[model samples]
Target: MSAFSRFTPLIRALPSTVPFVGPEAIERQRNLPVKARIGANESGFGPAPSVLAAIRARAGETWKYNDPENHDLKQALAVHLGIRADNIAIGEGIDSLLGLIVRLVIDPGSVVVTSFGAYPTFNFHANGFGCRLATVPYAGDREDLNALLDAVKREDATLVYFANPDNPMGSWWEADDIVAFTRALPETCLMILDEAYCETGPASAMPSMQALIEQPNVIRTRTFSKAYGLAGSRVGYAIGTPGTVQAFDKIRHHFGMNRIGMVAAQAALADQAYLHAVVGKIKKARERIAAIAADNGLLALPSATNFVAIDCGGDGVRARAVVDGLMQHGVFIRMPGVAPLNRCIRISVGPEHDLDLLAEALPQVLKAL
Candidate 1:
């Protein structure tokens, strides 16, 4: 039987594929089980015990639809961040929020600027919206802010994505520079500031909520996935002006949030001490990862995020070999997808056992390569 053929041209042109492959999928495809599970930037330290209790207590509410407005979560996050609840919008995660933001601002043929090899999900969302992408190369493993601003000006971009304490490379810019970048962007372009790793970065690396709150063109995204250890809960929020936030109400799935997920996020926010503890653990785990890299003669880049991107002392081929070999040993880790950066492999912060596994596998993998 023939398939229906009336889909939009954009849908037809987009390739059918899941861009970020999960560890579970790799396990199934490669007929191997993941032992360490440190590849996806997930916190193996897990969520706070209070959050787990909250989830368990709320599990019976699974049949209930979550509040479409996500009132409770937003109130909690607002208090946590000392921002007005009106300035926030909740989503399944930063990943979902990025898609909605792209859809909101981008039109077909509009230009979107981002760092080359910064975050694939942002690029994926831009492509899904049929927006033309203008990419700038990274400077010294960090997203080149000046270059990104230059590209946005050159292209007259309608949308731009910036990730401070960026992923894959795990590099970051200070708050002052980020504030300057946001101020420098023309009022004509909407900027998506993805700060999913805010929990793991330096306190000074995150700009004050009030700093960019007045700028309707800027939206800073944050998630519970990193130090909060709630990746599966899928709770993230964006901070912007009320006018900008109200736009999400127009198109977001009103009742899409899961009740248990909301409960988890609220509980997660309430436990500030736990968050601080996890951030400390993440810092320690990062040091362990860097030590493992040094043991193998690889150089780990200084990271402000939860993951460390290590220079494998060779080209992409060597980095890839180490990545593949580690996976073969049930030590799942990832590498950057582009050149220069691709010469490095990224390892997410996890428990001592996971890092122990990576420490064990990394040396053997490097020696074999």
Candidate 2:
């Protein structure tokens, strides 16, 4: 029963862990069905009908491997963003792309700077590469840009990960502030501006593509998962200088993009009207979530993302109880893992029926506590 002993030192040294325990896993472990699946920040509004039609139309072509160059998707994105196709690199999702970014820049013992409790998956990628993490605590529930810069300079870090309309807590900074932060960083430090939630945030919160597209040390990542409702497709792309993005071509899996997923993304991109409509729905859902929190006397923090973080007015313990109690009623949700931030429970925007489930279960959960 002995296992093979030839794994790399880094692999052997690392503990087995997933960045997030998915809802399906929670359901299996707790032996409860999830009635309202809104925990993982997924778009419960679903993709556009055109996107579904595109998938169905292309399902017959599933046997063919996707184009390694990702030509059509890149071209479509280029036209949409008013950028060149060469400036883009496509991946399965932001998560997979983060791993690639880490591999490209990090060596054993290299320093990686990030906000404490920012995105755990980025940390997972950094740890897998044997990079030492330098974390800065959040300032006023937002990622402290000034402190993050200081950490990068202090540690001489090689890579830094930041998210706009950040996850878990759902906070964000104005676009000008972000551009200023990017300009202030050491050119030696690569910055991953994870904009996975960009489409759902305010226009002022996103820097124009022309602002940082030419910055060699900066890579902006966006996904079809949120506003576009294509999480299952796993399609995401990075925007960077042509020279910087081309590096991905050297090491990326040639056919990692799936045919159906590519089709879904392309269709989703073409249907801007559908996207705008969904964004409106997402806004309403966020309001409903906040209203639910208010009804129970909890403070709902302002969010630029698809989820709302409701302050449970207690520490992680009380927040965790509400999470567990809601789950007991088949209403699945999540919360931050660190202190202060853990005082709030994070809930993703879903359809009215799902939010209704959350609304009904939340007060009952809090009452029980």
Candidate 3:
């Protein structure tokens, strides 16, 4: 594999990697069709009927670029969150925002802190910027906030990332603890408080909009993907002080927000009743998944998020076997990437049919193992 002759040192030195492997890629590699699409944390229930109607109505209007200022969507969000429109900066998604944040604060070798197996996308951005990463291991299947705080201070980190109602393990910390953690952080370090799963978590797990709004160093990122069923829309927003939010203008793709996606998010926000209904369905699905796991003699970890992590009663190898076994039965699923955390497998909440497939396949796969 011959590389480009004159690439920058940073580009040449960095390893090429994809943070996630979508189920479609697996199907292509194996020459198999996906029977139950439950591997990704996508809402199988999908966006609200109102949202679909909005998209259909606006399909012909896709010719125009979205408002680069994102005026109307920010106004709707401000009313919903009870925050000023000036506090919001809309982006393509949280992934894009993560990269922008890294660009803002990180120089080569700057320290960025996060949990060991926390969202890998944040780690991907850190690596791309040649930032030093300090990771704290999860304590008993949950992000050890105290250990993370310790690592941040010890490294004199410039940036820190924390996700409430986290991914993979699906654990969470209370709102007050998160607020306390923010206050305790040194003013010099900026915190990227990623709240991708906030709507699915308990109310106590989410801090109020007013909680850390005054701090210029604290930027909280939220997405329309998880509960709103807008993962494909790629619409997300960051809440921060006006001056801090303005910093995104320096590097963000001003016209990156697509017209259809913006309208979908706007409709999704207005349909709060639909969101509540789908959340109820998600809770029921979570319960069903736990029941299925329990029946098959696996332990389901407590989750404030939409997915559940199951302790597979062994090491990473055992967890890996389970994931592969499920795939063989056309039940696509995923597990953690590293050890300790990799001792568990992650199952996203999906429709009843998907759950039924998992339930039917588990015992057969275990017996084969």
Candidate 4:
């Protein structure tokens, strides 16, 4: 079974791993159907009717490859954000864009800075590119802004990944603080400000587009995957100065975006009213998730995203047991991957019936535990 072995040394040295073990894989491995299906932070509220209509309307165009330039989506985003089309770079999702960003700046052994337990996809991309990762531990369940800045300076890191309304913990800093952080970063160091959950967070937590759009060193990434209910579609974009974003054009896959997905994202952006309605539903679901945690005598950490991290009142072992117990009842959920943070099981907000399944299963899981 031996085959050609001319792969790069970095590729040969890497272990094969998925950043997140998806719920589908869990179902196949455990032989259990997922009743709630809220483990991966997808919007159970679903996309706007308008978005679906757009998809249906454009399904006939599936044979055509999406514009390599991503012109329509970029133009729509430009009008929406009040920025020029040149200021935006489109990608399949923030995950895809992270890889491209790494390729743009990181050489083998180049240092990349990030939070210790933040989003894992960015970390996966950094590793894939053979960059060294410098991680800063969370300070009080939030990314330590000061420590991240310090690490970037000390290492003169090639790239830094930071998430606003961060995942796993669902914590965030105010927009003003984020602006200050961006201002303090050295121009030579590139910063990726991931705002995937921005639509679900407080308005005060999101920095205005004008604040950092002009900074060539800063790239703010947002996605349709969260509040807009388009996780499967995988449409996201990066905002930065013209010179900065144009870098993507050099190496990006021409015509990489899906036609239907592009249509879905464009429709999602145009229907602001629908977006607001879905956001309201998401807010209520977050509250219900928190309430379910409270009912089980666990503390639901303060959340600014579509999910809540409920402290299970014990160590990783206890939290893991609860997660396993719930899955046994077809109530799929997740927990953080690292210590301290793994004490909490992360639950994505779903419709009432999904929460109903959770509400029914959680107590029994705890009682058994």
| lDDT of each residue in 1-369, candidate 3, tens digit only | 886799888888888899998899999988777888777888999999999999999899999998999999999999999999999999999999999999999999999999888899899999999999999999988888899889889999999999888888999999999999999999989999999989999998999999989999899999999899999999999999999999999999999998999999999999999999999999999999899889989999988877889988989999899998899889988888887999888998999999999999999988888
Model 2 per-residue lDDT tens digits across residues 175-245: 99999999999999999999999999999999999999879999999999889999999999999999999
Instruction: Tell me the whole-model lDDT of each prediction, alpha carbons only.
Output: 0.91, 0.94, 0.92, 0.93
What ranges in model 4 sit over 4 Å off? Answer: none
Cα lDDT of model 4 by residue, 95-205, tens digit: 999999999999999999999878888888999999999999999999999999999999999899999999989999999999999999999999999999999999999
Between which residue pairs do clashes occur in model 3? Answer: none
For residue 265, model 3's alpha carbon misses the true position, in angstroms, by: 0.4
* Segments in model 3 whose C-alpha atoms lie over 4 Å from true places: none
Which 10-residue window of candidate 1 scores lowest in summed lDDT? 360-369
CA shift of 363, model 2, Å: 0.8
User: Where does candidate 2 stray beyond 4 Å?
Assistant: none
lDDT of 1 by residue, 244-314 (tens): 99999999999999889889989989999999999999999999999888888879999998999999888
Better of 2 and 3 by lDDT: 2
Off by over 4 Å in 1: none
